[model samples]
Target chain A: MQRSLAARVAARTAALRLTNEKLYNEILERRKAERALRATERKYRGFFENSIEGAYQSTAEGQYLNVNPALARLYGYATTAEMMAAVGNIARDVYADPEMRLRFQEMIERDGKVRNLEYQVRQRTGEILWISESARVVRNRSGKIVCYEGTIRDITARKRAEDEAARLRQQMLQLQKMDAIGTLASGIAHDFNNILGGIMGYVELAQDDLPPGSGAESHLKEVWKAIHRAKQLVRQILAFSREAAPERRKVRLAMLVSEATRLLRATIPATVAIEEEILTETDEIIADPAQIHQVLVNLGTNASHAMSGRAGRLLLRLEHAAIGGKKPALKLSVRDTGHGIPPDILQRIFEPFFTTKGVHEGTGLGLSVVHGIVKSHGGEIRVESTPGAGTTFMIFLPLALEAPQ
Target chain B: MAHILVIEDDEHMRGSLAQTLERLGHRVTTAVDGKVGVASAAVAPPDLVITDLIMPEKEGLETIMELRQHQPSIRIIAMSGGGRLSNEDYLHLAKRFGAQFTLAKPFTRDELKAVLAQALAS
Candidate 1:
């Protein structure tokens, strides 16, 4: 009996010792696995901190799990801790437009990864910056989305440079348009000047041959009058051809208006009434006399045509005013009681070849030429009108103190 | 009356020139091309010839050269609108090829009469 009992005790002690050894081995294996996980995390942290681009990890719900110092600086925060405290949800706090975060989520869900997503992100100070991000979904072992990891780079300066280059290209196109118009004018002027020379020469010869009191002399006088009218037409052509220079002279605005009105009265139908209001007696301006005359004539003719088949009043008013506190200027306003310009067409009225008149009646260069002349003389012209009311053109020219002899 | 021959390609300008010269009491003959002009000048030897520079079949420079060879002292007047040639080049070629004088296109009646009178006197 004693020997049997002793064998039992020995068996039990051996079983206990085996169990302890197995437990110790299991603990050691678990400790080794923990150390390996810590090393991997340390290596990842080091890489994230040292990288130039911003590194971040966010939950699918947009909660930040980890962010590098580079990310905090990129977002205009002083430290990662500060950014984490303020920016609780990246989708809500950092993205200026919340739709951007949703778009990123959609991209990743569709493609398993989102590449180079560019958007404007709001900083801590409410300022916005452009950021480019490339990110991938972080998944658990079962392929379920847990978080997202991404790199961000600032691209604001590059975007600004592209916009500036586009603006300069548009400006160059406008200059090219002006250059082409100048070339066309030079060619047309050379041909037209020759024709005018022939006409003028023959008129002078016809005048010398006709007797003073005969019927032929009266007929010759009428022909001479027509030739004089044709010469004025030639001058207008020369203006566009670049052959004629602007004849600048210091003249009173009142006298210019009177002379223009007197000439226009003969051409406009007797039904249309013409009136003038000279507010300033000494309002003087330096301008090309011939060009100014042409401007007045063109405006008057346009007004007459606008009031065709209707009784209307055309008013030519001259006044003196100060602009921008610099100098006093003479203001000439041509107002007509006729159909007003539409809103859509007012913007393009000064463009070349844009006219409402029927074919063969208007060349469409009248307003464009007027605009060019006004711009060349350092003056300003503006049109004011309503849909139902008539239109008024007010031209402001710097006043000249010296008077013509 | 002085007999004058005119050669021009454009119908309107040619007709205007012929009428103006006829009104001035000069006998005028019109030709539409340089070859016809040269042939007319050769057969009749008109008192004066005014021909345009650019034309079909026979150009103005060649016509002037051939006309001078046929009638050495025929008194030719060259006219052009300076279309393809510069003013200086046109004058140079005309004088070089034995033309008495040259006038630009769209010439006035007075200028035509004066140049014709000068060419006839010379």
Candidate 2:
């Protein structure tokens, strides 16, 4: 009986050892599988962290569930946590146009995916950024949408470059139009000059045949003067069309002021008269004769408009001034007895596009262009006025040391 | 005084111009266009041919060139009341085509006379 009992106990011990070894191998296999799974998860996490393209996962209700660092940076946030806190609803708060996100969602829902969808989004800083997104709807086994997954790429720089190219093309077209107008203007000016030539030549021929101081000769002189004024108008139009650079030369201001006033007299109502106080003898400045003539004409026109057809005196003065009795400068002043400028707007008179005149009356560029021309020639201009009395514009220009070449 | 040929398209202008030249004591012949003017000049070969630059047939530029080919020593005066080109531009071209003198239209009689004197003297 003792020997049988000992043999059964030995068999039981061997079976227990065999079961323990199998349990140990099974535990080792499970640990190896767990370690392999953890390595795969880490590889994907690294991809999410280092990717340049923005990646995000959002709930069906538009709440951000997961966002990579790139996505946070693109939204103008310091961190993903900050982006999530700042943006509560993606469709309402993120999209520049909320409808765009709705359309994107509808497309993803219908097709299971959307590729290269373009939209504008407002960054956290309140600036709009152009972006293109490729996204897919994440659904559960029941085919119900649980969330959305997508990548966003900023296309703001590309859009800006395209806009700049379009602007350049428009500018080129404007320049071409100007060139065509210039060609047409040349032809018109030639024809007008020919007509004037006929009138001037006949008047001179009739004068040559007339006796000295005859009444007819004096009458012919008046007709010739009118034609001279007409010629000046034509020249001004030609200069504008050609955009010719002012022909800079030593020019006397007195001659230009009187000529401009004489031309103004024929156009303005007789109630308005012109006065001149030009005393500068041979005081010459380097200038384009036509441009100086234009400056006077513009100021005279402005003065006339201010008067508004009422009787008034337009005083034009040209003089030589010495600052502190040392440095010499040429001074010109245009004074108008009219409804003067109000104090509030006097400062903005020289600002470009600031005009009180109606659209058909003026472009408001007159004063600004005058200011630019004076500044380019090293000059200063100022205005003085009393609301009820009158207004005067004073212009000072440095004398050319030697005539500009 | 020399024999002058006036080629003008406008009748009124031609009449006035012809009268003025006659008063200055010069013998003058008139033609309506460059074609008639060339034929008239070839028949008589006047001392000086005053041709208009822009004409309906055989325009002034071509007229001047053709006249120079026929008579290399011909004294020619070209005048124009500008067309598509500027009067100065037309005048410059005329000078290039062997015109001795160029007058812009509606020029003073004294101016025309002065150009004629200079052309005849040279």
Candidate 3:
């Protein structure tokens, strides 16, 4: 009986040892699994922290749950924690337009993912920047959206470049269209001049045969007036089409302006007050005096027309200007306290043959000729108008260097 | 009175010009084109020649050069109603080709008289 009892105790001891060994081996296996899991987590965190693109995790309500360092910097924040604290709602605090966020959410919900969604967002400094994002909706086991995860890149420079290219392309197309029109107009003008010459010659001969102060003489005077009008129209068309190259020389702009203003004074209505404010000490420019004179006359005429039938002030001013470290320039401004041009018509003012005046009042080539002259002179023109107030035309021309005495 | 030759393709313009020259008290001869004008000058050699720039047979520039070579002392006046080029441009080119005077067509009688007198005096 004693031997049997000892054997039972030994068997119980071995069973206890086996149970302890199993327990230790289980602990070692659990530790190995935990280490591997921690290593994988560190690797993913490294990717999140060091990525150049902004990585983010936000709730369905547009609250950022996690943001990488790159995302914090992109939003103009110094720290991820600071950005999280500041940006309470992504749509309100981040998006330039809140509607974009709704669109983004709709896209993700419908497609389960979004690739390269472009958006404009407001940065921390209140500056708007363009950003491109690729994101996916994180769903729970029940297929309900839990959050959104995304990577974003700042694309403001790219967006600006694209916009500038499009603008340049549009400008090129406009130039080509204008050139085609000019060629066609010039062809017609040449033929018209010939026919006009024949009529004018005949009319002059007939006038010489009629006695002065007779009723026929007065009637011939009217015919002469019509012929003069036709002549002026042909000349204007030629100028607008740039058929005749301008003869450029060293021109005294001050003298030209005074001469033009004097003519304007006589031609425009006497009711309109004329004011000249020539402030520049050196008003020399290497330009065609005739073309420059025409520019002034055209601008002045338009100013007078704007003030017609109303007692308004016409102001002509010349001043020196510094323009972005470029060549020295002179700025000539024609301002009138008359009815301003409407916004819709202002943009089309430089187009050839675009006129708002009555058929007899204008030929519609004035501004177009002015624009062409300015462009050929390597200058620029700008117009500003306020409805019911006035209109101002500013012309910038390069100053001519002093010639040798 | 000076003997003059007028070269013009238009019939009415040629008649009007011939009458005007007669009124101005000049002996006038008319030609239909540069070819006829050159031939007439080669035969008669008038004191002054007023030729249209754009013509059917031979243009004014070529006519002026040929006429200048034949009669270097003969005074020449170039006229045009303009064509592909402006009248001023054509007149400018004509002046370069030994034409002593230039006229844009449809010129007033006074303008015509002025250039005619200048050409005769020169």
| Backbone clashes in model 1, listed as residue pairs | none
How many backbone collisions does model 3 have?
0
Those runs of model 3 whose alpha carbons end farther than 4 Å from true positions after fitting are A1-33, A207-218, A239-285, A288-399, A403-405, B1-19, B22-100
* Cα shift from native, residue A15, model 3 (Å): 8.9
* Per-residue C-alpha lDDT of model 1 across residues A203-260, encoded as one tens digit per residue: 5556666777767777766866775575466445544544356677777768878877
Could you tell me the TM-score of candidate 1?
A: 0.42
List native contact recovery per candidate, as a fraction of 1. Answer: 0.10, 0.15, 0.20
RMSD of each: 21.7, 20.8, 17.0
Ranking by DockQ: 3, 2, 1
Model 3 chain A: ten consecutive residues of lowest lDDT: A168-177
**Per-model C-alpha lDDT, please?**
0.75, 0.78, 0.83
- Per-model TM-score of chain A alone? 0.47, 0.49, 0.58
Per-prediction DockQ comes to 0.07, 0.09, 0.17
**What lDDT tens digits, residue by residue, belong to model 2 across residues B1-122?**
88999987766567767777887889999999999989998999989998877666776766887888888999999987653234555676678777979987656677887999899998
B-chain TM-score, every candidate?
Answer: 0.92, 0.96, 0.97
Q: Which is the better candidate, 2 or 3, if ranked by lDDT?
A: 3
Candidate that beats the other on DockQ, 1 or 2, i.e. the better one: 2
lDDT (tens digit, per residue) of candidate 3 on A110-166: 998999999999999999999999999999999988999999999999999678656
List the candidates' TM-scores in order: 0.42, 0.48, 0.59
